[model samples]
Target: MRAVPRPAILGSIAAVLFLACVAPEDRGTDATNLRDPWAIRAEPGDPALAAGKEIFASCASCHLADAGGRSDGTIPRLAGQRAEILEWRLRGLQDGSIDLPVMTPFARALTEAEIRQVSAYLASLPRPERIGSASGGVNERGAKLYHDRCRSCHSAEADAVAASNAPRLCGQHEAYLLRRLEDMASGNAGGAGAARAVDPAMEAIAIALSMEDRLRVSRYLARSECD
Candidate 1:
């Protein structure tokens, strides 16, 4: 048998000792941390907001001048979204966890500070009125589904709990919401690193819902009002 070098043997022992010293939470290989540093509020009159508005000019082409997005449900409204959620999504796009062809490039273009600034700016805007055509029928089934499964994280109150990661869904376009549900169910909503942005529980729920149930839930959220 070939003999191991003395230096190599010592190096292996040193490496093992170093790993043992690492804290449990700090030793994990997962790169995605949900409690991120970027999810912070920018107060009114903050310089970040001003710079963000200028930077948002590029986004206006697709999201519209007011960030209301397209009424046809091709785009999603950004106005009044939670700043934390916006920042998280932007970071996910930049890191390749959440991959949207149209959005990834835009997200990658921004620096860390720019991501925070733009998120705060978008969150400050007034949420637009319901922007698309509604299904215009009874949504009791959808409401029940939401109440049973979704309300805990996505509260229906005017002011949802800020600490939760869930984004507000009321008044979102039905088609867009439905498509997202489909994507989540099929495990196509995000990229390889999607575990950071896409909750396993959410994916399970989406998979459990039938096609018609998904549509009904989407319709219910689309017409629902929020503060």
Candidate 2:
């Protein structure tokens, strides 16, 4: 038997205590560690709106200058997203609730006002045309799955996206949709997961989806075009 040093034992104990006792907000200022220090608003106006447009230059790389996002489903479409949805997404990233590495740093860098402004700016963009690629095959099963489970909240039509708090899924990139569906089902989604589960009902829905079901529905939605 080996003797354990008292100092080493005490240090291990201290580390455990820190992990257990420290609040999430006190951790650090990185996107995954910091909490929103001010009230989060999404409405755009005056000085903040202008400032946000200026700040958006850094985000243009992946999101595009128009914030239309990539069509391959690798990056999500931010264009025409609701301000509230944007705010929630950014907040989740900032607070470590969402695990998007690319978004976390950008969200963390913003001030409270900047968050609001950026959200508003993104929300203000006109939605781009649906150009993402979809699998070539009959999607009737996937359509049925969506109608049976997802239609009530997400709706079948494009207009429903703007009216509801939920983001538009129809005609979105298939890969992106698949990723989100899988994340939600796996309890890794930000608000839609076990960690925050801000929408517990949504969590229930997500949890109920199997991997096959997610793929089917995502492919169907991704292939859809707005009429």
Candidate 3:
């Protein structure tokens, strides 16, 4: 067996200790005090957009300059995501409802206005023409699964309102989708310190699907084109 490097072990220990020291209540921003994210928009040439671009620099390290995320699906693409959704998730991370370790600290550092600015900046970016995928081949079974189970909420129509705040799944990374499905099925979708309740309907759907079916669906969604 390969021995772990001392520096790597020490770094991991430091990270764990840091997270442990930060109490959920003490972490950061108040979600309730935030303004309506949907109401905020940063158009091109706006000062807010410029500020947002600066703020987004911190995020680019993980999400990438193009916000395309990693092909391995460790991260989710931020480009072309709805500002409303982005703000919502950021608020969730800030308030300890979402609980992503890497994101929580960053989200907590931002003020409500900063969140709006960054969300708008990311939304302004174009969606990736080529999204990350785990496999090259399309799964026909996955297509059927998506059409039957997911199409209603994750509509392909440009004018369609997201049902139940369901995000655009098409063009997402397959591994990320699969991981989320597995987490939802196992009642572990949210990380530690998650105060907000998980959606019962989505959880139920995830639990109902077999592992193979989840993979199929994820693969299908990854290959799909966004309008």
TM-scores for the candidates: 0.71, 0.61, 0.73
Looking at model 1, the pairs that clash are none
Q: By lDDT, who's the top model here?
A: 3
lDDT of 1 by residue, 106-138 (tens): 556667887678778877887775543467685
**Tens digits of per-residue lDDT for model 3, 95-146:** 6655556555655666798767877887788877786566869788988887
**lDDT, candidate 3, at 81:** 68
Q: Considering lDDT, where higher is better, how would the candidates rank from best to worst?
A: 3, 1, 2
What clash pairs does model 3 have? none
The weakest ten consecutive residues by lDDT in model 1 span 13-22
Q: C-alpha displacement of 6 in model 3, angstroms? A: 27
Of models 2 and 3, which has the larger TM-score? 3
RMSD of 3: 8.9
Cα displacement (Å) at residue 98, model 2 = 7.3
lDDT of 3 at 227: 71
Model 2 has an lDDT value of 0.55
Q: After superposition, how far is residue 50 of candidate 1 from its true place, in Å?
A: 2.0
